[model samples]
Target: MSTAHDRERAWLLVTRREVVSRITDKSFLIGTVLMVAMIVGFIGFTAWQEERTDEATLGATPEAVAMAQAVADAAPQVDDKLEVRLVELDDDAAARAALEADEVDAWLHPVDGDWQLTSESSEQDSLTAATRVVVRQQVLADNAARVGSTVEELEAGSTVGTEFLRGDAERAAVAEAVGFVFVFLFYFAALVFGMQLASSVIEEKQSRIVEIIAAAIPLRHLLAGKVLGNTALALIQLLVYLAVGLVGLTFTPYKSYVPALSGPAAWFLAFFLAGFVALACLWAVAGSLASRTEDLQATSTPLTMLMLVMFFGGLSLDGRGQVIASFVPPVSAVVMPKRILAGGVDWWEPLAALGLLAAFALATVWVGERLYRRALLQTGGRVSLRQAWSAAE
Candidate 1:
């Protein structure tokens, strides 16, 4: 008689069948399309935001051209470049006419050696604020010049110098957004796929299919095939996302960011494998503990909770917290990527994390195989952990 250990063909066939079944599933197809759409939409939205910046139109009299020049010299806070389009007019009437006709965002006219600005709304925009600052500075200089003194003299030579510390924080907002996307995608996908492995195991057990399959194939092969097949699908989905994302990034000006992000991206894949397998084994264990979908909640709740903690906790880590996560299994997959995106990660962290996670994954597989062999044949009701533990392997 051919036993599961006598030959690997039966289990290999089982793995192939599972991979084909999942890849051809209608829900999987729809989910893939939706995921692609969301990622594309996100990339499009980012491109739009990068292109959109505040613009200001300034209407000024021919004599008040200095006001426009001052506005031009002051950079708007939005893009660090002031877009002050000057519409020259002969008098205040023409300027007001332009302003009322929406020809300019705001207008400036000279009155008895003083300048007055007119706008449609009380709320100030970046351009408007910049224009105000320039006008004030110019007026101060002019007042000092009238008295044969300088604006500097009036300030008593006290100038406040403010410096911006970009230091790994310059791209903070962007990094945080991208890292959130990366972490959450991995976090949610891992949980969903892990549960899928569990549900498949339970489904096969509940249908009594495992009895026939185990009779023909070793229980270990069966367990390995199920985990391998689902993991392959999960990886295909993740790679698709990464490829689409890279393509999108290439189209945008942010393509330069790819090289820096690639390391973390690679780590994400490595950790994802280790993390998924570690969790996937538990999922298999969870499935073997239950005979039906209804019975899965109690068995799988701990698995779900562990994933949730990793997801939320990974989001909260900083420098030291992230380093600590790098040594920890599963969550390290997420934490390390975030640090990479944030920049300033050490060189050895990824290697260390990957090693630790791989070790844990191997241990999990051992335990999960034992659990599967013990409980996969038990039926009719929920199989408690105690019962499965005491059952012959």
Candidate 2:
């Protein structure tokens, strides 16, 4: 009989082979580079878009320069990043020339004791609104002086202060964004790696390599090696992507979301490992049932559907349903971390959910091992789950 140490060595050799083959594959390396580029490019694009300033130049006759300046100063109150620049015009003809030459976004002058705003085409609503407010304030100040009162006194009781009953609105928005990221990463990694694991298993069988390998090492060891190896690769790739994303985020306005997301991100990785292992086992079983690559789709339909449900559920579920989903295995992998990020969950809730996921992973491994062992050597056609379960070892 093989000693425990020898069995450990045998399985470890298989694990090493799996890891080496994947890392050495040209396609995998190329895909990693492309993904990193996409992430960096996206972050750069977002930063560029955010940093761009909206500028509006207005041509004003000398007399209206002060009004234009007031509009410029007040424009930020309407939209913080808006810049209204004033260009002096000698007369109406100069203003018209400036508008025709695209030297100004609009033209402003006095008409019939009221202000007139003219543009070559449609005017920006924000600029129009800001100019209206400044004009109204100037008129109000004049009226106030006639009545021996101040604009401040007339507007003192009109300002409204905001209050949030639940939490900071900005923080809540950040949490929602973080939760969406978690859901997407989990869904993507699990589906990609799970399918890869299944394909590896079926390919080995198709080439008749598994039979020779199985004779040397226990089938359980083979199964363990494949699952653990792929899990490691999946985790490593995920961490690299997340690291790149976090580093990129530091240069964006959303960098503030980092601290808020850090805790939940860590928990997500932990839950991901357990949940991935469970799904990996099922994927292995799916592969073992297939007699060829052509049958893979037929056997893996259920797993695909499950992943879809998890994806949509993580994004759409809310209220009491969300609370209940945080305890369910697999789905909990995404939901529990989201709830934690959203706040209001007790600390024990994630711990309990992780515990349940771990247990489910263990159970899947046991059942999957039996099915894989029985169906791996069957060559003529695809094997049904019941036939695999009942087959003699």
C-alpha displacement of 242 in model 1, angstroms?
A: 1.3
- Residue lDDT tens for model 1, 32-76: 999999999989998877777666788778888877867765655
Root mean square deviation (Cα) for candidate 2: 3.1
Off by over 4 Å in 1: 1-6, 57-69, 72-82, 85-124, 143-174
Clashes of 1: 1
Q: Each candidate's lDDT (Cα)?
A: 0.80, 0.88
How do the predictions measure up, each by TM-score?
0.82, 0.86
Instruction: Estimate the TM-score for candidate 1.
Output: 0.82
Q: Output the lDDT of residue 175, model 1.
A: 73
Q: What is the lDDT of candidate 1?
A: 0.80
lDDT of 2 by residue, 1-393 (tens): 667788778868778887998989998889888988998998899888888778899789988998898888788887776889889899999999999899998988999988999999887776888788888998899999999999999999999987755467877887887788889988888888888888988898899998988877898889988888888888998898888888888999889887767788899899899989999989999999998999999999999999998899999999999999988988998999889988878889999999998998899899999999999999889999999999999
Model 2: lDDT equals 0.88
- Per-candidate clashes come to 1, 0
In model 1, the worst 10-residue window by lDDT is 162-171
